[model samples]
Target: MKVSLFITCLTDLYAPTVGMAVVKTLEHFGCQVDFPADQTCCGQPAFNNGYPEHARTLAQRMIEVFKKADYIVTPSGSCCAMIRDHYPHLFADDEVHQPEALEFVGRTYEFIEFLTKILKVDLTPYRLPEPVDFTYHYTCHLRGLEMTGDPCIGLLRQIGNCRFVPLEKAEQCCGFGGTFATKYPDISGAIVRDKVQCGNRTRAQVMIVNDGGCAMNIGGAGHRYGSTFAVRHAAEIIATALEGGKDNARR
Candidate 1:
């Protein structure tokens, strides 16, 4: 499949390694991946900050930028949720742009969902270099996308040497609701503190977060709270598993 990577602003600016992992994982499955340099923010920050006009402008540009893409993928669930769950509403009154917005939503997918759903990927052959006990935090926006099931956990189970560490309150938000974190630092801090504690309780080696913003918030708080686990992106973990599997097969 021809896939266009929508490297979200947070991923592009803060976690470029996650972007590389997404690309590597996709290519390992025979995908033709390309990056659209003109792509910009999906206007999520502006929309969340209550500036509809500015958000609409950015959404319009995003629609135009990836007009030719066969499939659009991003590592950040929140950014994908902004496009799929909210973009149509942003252009609902505009008859001219609403259809395009829907089309944009149809093609866009969060990284893990695309792998498990659209690609129907089977990672049963893969194994981590060593067993890893890891927990996952489902980002809040993922529920908005109707991904109520544990697709990510299901995929993680396929890695032979990895253990799925069930996180307490996995569905709870990590307190990184874009500007919500900044606008209410105390509330955000408290929420993330609880989240990090939950992860700590799992006693896992790493916490896998699919959204860059959530990873940043939880990772930082985990450090401050002296968490026992490291925070990681799902793509990075999957990439590591696939690399190990490839090396083992070569041997």
Candidate 2:
């Protein structure tokens, strides 16, 4: 499969290792992964901040870059949802772009959903060096994209002795709604604080989030309070399982 990596702006800048892991994991499953160098932000931040024109400009660049990709995969559920669910509306009035927009969104898949549902690659060959307890935070767009069942957990189950702990209100947002967190700091801060608190309550050593924004938000808060739990991106965990096992998975 010719998989094109739509490494989100967050991953490109903040968590490039997760993006690298995604490539390694996909290649391990026999996929030919391509990293389109010119790809930029997926336009979700601008679009969510009520700047559709700016967002459309950003979207046009991505549309041009990955149109020929056999599969457009990204570690971001938020971006996947934006391109898949919102891009059509963003271009609804433009007859020239709408059809192609639909086609592009159809080809886009969030990394976890692509790995679990679309690719269905077997993971029996990978396992953790030690059993680790993990709790999943359901990021917003994964649910919006109908990426239900927290597919990452199912993927984790394939790893040897990885424990899945139940988190209270797993579907709740971590309060990092792009610029929403910046515009409404108090509300966002409180939401993320409560979310980290909830994850702490689960007593899971590792807190897993599908979206980088959520992981950063929740993980940041956890670190500030010196919470015992460690936060990680799903791609990092999966890549660790494939590469080094549990010891290397620790951040």
C-alpha lDDT of all candidate models, in order? 0.91, 0.85
Best by lDDT: 1
Q: At residue 76, give the lDDT of candidate 2.
A: 86
Q: Please, what are the lDDT tens digits per residue for candidate 1 over residues 145-229? A: 7888978989988877778989999888999888889999999999999999999999999899999999999999988989999
Which runs in model 1 stand beyond 4 Å of their true positions? Answer: 246-251
Count clashing residue pairs per candidate: 0, 0
What is candidate 2's lDDT per residue for 126-199, written digit by digit as tens? 77777889988888887678867777888887776588999998878889998888889999999999998898
Cα TM-score of candidate 1: 0.97
Global Cα RMSD, each model: 1.4, 3.1
Please name the candidate that would achieve the greatest TM-score relative to the true structure: 1
- lDDT for model 1, please: 0.91
Model 2 is weakest, by summed lDDT over 10 consecutive residues, at: 242-251
- State the local distance difference test value for candidate 2: 0.85
**Native-to-model Cα distance after best TM-score fit, residue 81 in candidate 2, in Å:** 0.6
